[model samples]
Target: MSRAIEVILRDEIFTELEIEYPDDRNTNLLEQGMDSAGFLKLVVLMESKFNIAVPDEDLLFENFSTAGLIIHYLTEKTMS
Candidate 1:
């Protein structure tokens, strides 16, 4: 599942943001040129792709700061 999430993030980051996904999953996306719009696009994509609703409280920069973090957040979401 984490692998899948990483792939989706890589593809979407390239497709939607027109930016290369960092090789390091722990790299900060905001520092990599991911802006607010890109972030919202990712949130929507994750909801649609994973079939999970991300609560308002979970929509934090820390949660989506990197691919690894997103995978971790989604893994926890899917587990519950």
Candidate 2:
């Protein structure tokens, strides 16, 4: 699932956002040209693709700051 999420994020979300997927999954997306619009797009894509609604409280930078973190968050959300 983590690999799948990484692929979608790299091939779909990042492409739509016009941002390049970093070589390092732990790279900070905000530093990689991900702006507010990109972040919103990411959230929307994750919700639709994962079939999970992200609560407002989970909208923290730590949860979405990097690809690895996003995958981890989605993994936990889907499991619960």
Candidate with the greatest lDDT versus the true structure: 2
TM-scores of the models, in the order given: 0.85, 0.88
lDDT of 2 by residue, 1-80 (tens): 77887788789877877889999989999889988777888899889877999999987777899888888888888888
Residue-level lDDT of model 1, residues 1-80, one tens digit each, is 77776787678645776767888888998878889888898888888878999999988888889878888988888888
Residue pairs whose backbone atoms clash in candidate 2: none
Candidate 1: misplaced stretches above 4 Å?
A: none
TM-score, prediction 1:
0.85
Question: Which regions of candidate 2 are displaced past 4 Å?
Answer: none
Worst 10 residues of 2 by lDDT: 1-10
Evaluate residue 73 in candidate 2 and report its C-alpha lDDT on the 0 to 100 scale: 88
